[model samples]
Target: MKKLSVFFALLFLAFVSLPAHAGEIPIGIYGTLTGTDTDVNGMSYGPKDYLTYVNERAGGVMGHKYVPILLDGKNSIPEEVKVFKRLVEVEKVVLVNGWSTGGTKALRDQINTLIKIPFQAQSLSSDVLDPQKYPFIFLLGPTYEDQVLIALNYAKQKGAKTFAFIHADIEYGRAPVRNALEQKIPEKLGLKVLADIEYAGGSPDLTPQLLRVKELNPDYVYIQDSAGNTVKILRDAAKVGVPAGKFFGNNYNFQHIIPGTLGKDAEGFKALQINADWGENIPMMKEIEEFGRKQKIEKKDAYYTKGWVQGKVIHELISRVLKKTGGKIPEIGQFRIMLKDEWVKLENFDTGGGTPALFYKDHQGHTQARIVEVKAGKFATISDWIKTR
Candidate 1:
């Protein structure tokens, strides 16, 4: 009788010790964590770390923590599709963050129609912003087209007459450059484009291209490439004596890691970025700093902060649902429904001041970017927020 009573008591205690929520809110994120274009580590890590901080510090979103299953796409589109399936069908995740232009564009139809899971991605392709076509896929920032417009507008203001365009021979590299050269500049902005050049990513020598750029001497050079490839371009341009001040970069190339890699060669380099720099003491960044210290993270950058903002948006939606339902976390379907019906209407949504206020009705979320210049081994915001759309 005493053994039976003790067993009952222990069972009751175990039941009480279990967490109040049924299970974690599973979210999926896939990015190019490794491979040649591995700058996404900071981008992917930021959101993961913010979710970790939420669970550890804020008691999670309504006491149900975000359980993220992250995978590395290795910058491959096919691999990314497989990872997406694994996250959705196999893992049954309700929300996801994707990477790469090819992967995001490839999965847009399925994610919107068949899967019906809410997705936000790192790719800034303008095609994905159509609400009628891709209702489930949200872009984390302005589109590549918008970035191009903003960069060109800035160039025009700075007395740039003609432009030299350089990009990798890939979809991501081609998309914005194509839009700018073929449509935006000639028709809309009335700017002159001198030379359009395509090079393979991570090319060892860009002397031929830099030599061409030097000959043209366009008022500015707009480069659409990753950090690794950007290093090659800038170094080769310096060697070829292309004026450093005449060079500008897209958002992916505006990373802090680039300046560190280029040292003195990176001086006067300008690039467009979607968010504030690392050391900016925004409200959310203060919290992130504390979280970083606890986790032994010595540095944080713009990409990391961008990821953190993505996680924050997901958390905010879940939080609203939980609040409305009296601490009851909604099911996956309900969560999707809530986002589609109500959550997206959120106006002036705070993305930690990393980017502009996100107004989701237009489906592009604050089509604004800041220009940053590398000065004294760090990136500094040189211009006020400029709307691109």
Candidate 2:
């Protein structure tokens, strides 16, 4: 009887040593689901839908389903901070996917130092790429500065000398423009800055700003704003006699639905294409389409693809770790270490045609951009995937 008791005690000890939450992986998502600057709603939805599909079809990563605690900050910094803290402390999520430049920056130190959870931000802010300062923060693609640099390079190739930089008076809009106008354009590309314009985001009228841009007669105009304001800017620019063909925008401006939404106003609008176009005959696109068909989701935009790609990365890393551990989820530190050590080694990661290739050695997944121009009511690839300095 004593020997039997000893054997049962050993078995209980082994069972207790196993992970408490073995069958469920808890992750967190923070984005602006309902806000004025909520153009990326579809983007957030893409990942959510993909993860749902994974849970439904493939039984999730290594037979463990993801329990995503999603929160909306409504594009407010204070609100984002509150939500982020709750996600880390209360929810006890091991990983989080965040959005908004302001919120990401605000939570950088806490998430990196205190919480120590691996985080991927949708913000392409250059500050987020500094692995030394933000060891926990990972970006999906090229920094916003790189996007601006690509724009400058394309404009230079097309013989555009003087340029007008227009962006919202927000951190997301200001950071890249500052990098371009104050540093990269002059130091590297040797381009002339004609005007630095700013306008209220989602403003009904940008005629005053476009008039100022027209006064300078800039050879090219670089805009950093959301899709809605982008259309407004283009329309007002046309009315103010700033040719739409001379305009260029950032990655956020290049949604697949813009042309159909803006009709002729979106003509000649060129922006950096970080991912493959939606209708492109790519394997990822086909997969997304089939997934959408089954889910009855009709609007799969660029933002959606972006979100899906982010989810894919998370799924890949977790699946890899689980496979290596014989279906055991690693501890939080182990998970973070594996992501930093093993996942960053991924070469030319398949981002479902959303990006060319993703390798996060220094935490910047993409370093190139493809320029796409609005022609005949649709985005047309105008240049190859050009490398950024």
- The TM-score leader among the candidates is 1
* Residue 90 C-alpha lDDT in model 1: 84
Clashing pairs in 2: 43-303
Q: Superpose all Cα atoms of candidate 2 onto the true structure and report the RMSD in Å to 1 decimal.
A: 4.8
TM-score of decoy 1? 0.91
Count the clashes in each prediction.
0, 1
Tens-digit per-residue lDDT, 296-356, candidate 2: 6534577777887888888887877777788887776777666656556766787767787
* TM-score of each predicted structure versus truth: 0.91, 0.90
State residue 328's C-alpha deviation in candidate 1, in Å. Answer: 3.6
RMSD of each: 2.8, 4.8
Query: Best-fitting candidate, measured by lDDT?
Result: 1
Candidate 2 residue spans exceeding 4 A from truth? 1-21, 296-298
Report the C-alpha displacement of residue 198, candidate 2, in angstroms.
Answer: 1.0
Off by over 4 Å in 1: 1-21, 296-299, 329-331
Computed on alpha carbons, the lDDT of every model, listed in order, comes to 0.80, 0.79
